[model samples]
Target: MKAEFFTDAKPLTVSKENFGLERGPLAHVLVNAMLVSDTAKGGSLQYQVGYQLVYKPDSPGKKLPALITTPDMSSFCRLFLERGKHYLLGGMLDQNGGARVDLCSLAIPWKNVTGKQHRELLSYRCD
Candidate 1:
């Protein structure tokens, strides 16, 4: 998705009472990560992971795979992640331990994450 599309997105904020209400299970994994490289892997696009956000239990840590996968859909339906930009990615993890992002996932530019949002993310809990 384009960063421009999120220009007017609602500010990311979470409170103990409103956290899951707004976010729901939008993603099982969430992080502010930079795209290191993009490689065509079979039918999916594998993006090399770079600098990653550390948000305790939700961060995924270093074991968060070197690559994150997304569908290689047609131009109009696919996600275009730039190699150098950082994104706040929110998506599911497959059984094999690989993460998968789709057009519907909470993928947004890292710059879009406000200070309050970052703090909320840092203290995010799955409970």
Candidate 2:
């Protein structure tokens, strides 16, 4: 399974909200991330942490790639998401219609968690 996140943040632009286009600055990079089942042994999430990086400095250059990792050596307190679950992300945007989003953290943390490293007792699927 796979997941998708969207945002309008300008983390890549030094202008704070602009992509350096109005200011004629170099471009920063952005990436896409998803939450999937971490099907590793003794894994609590049954989900894998993955990301799709956006790079290349050119128009639509290599639209990033989806990345995933096993839940090996992971713990609780970081279960901002679950397996087969779809998350909605938002952030600042550029004038040229590009999103400068950050994928390393969650704007909202999930309440269904304990001090232990684990996900909620459920599995999800997309439409």
Candidate topping lDDT:
1
Residue range 1-127, candidate 2, lDDT tens digits = 1112322222354564433522111121222344345555444322222322221223343332233222333353333444443333223234443432333323223232343412221222223
Write candidate 1's Cα lDDT for 1-127 as tens digits: 2211111113344456433222212222233244433345356666665535534433333344556666676552456677767777655454444555668666768878789988787677656
Extract clashing residue pairs from model 1.
none
| Every model's TM-score | 0.58, 0.22
Alpha-carbon runs more than 4 Å astray in model 2: 1-61, 70-77, 89-104, 107-127
TM-score of 1: 0.58
In model 1, where do residues sit more than 4 Å from their true spots?
A: 1-42, 56-62, 75-77
lDDT of each: 0.51, 0.30
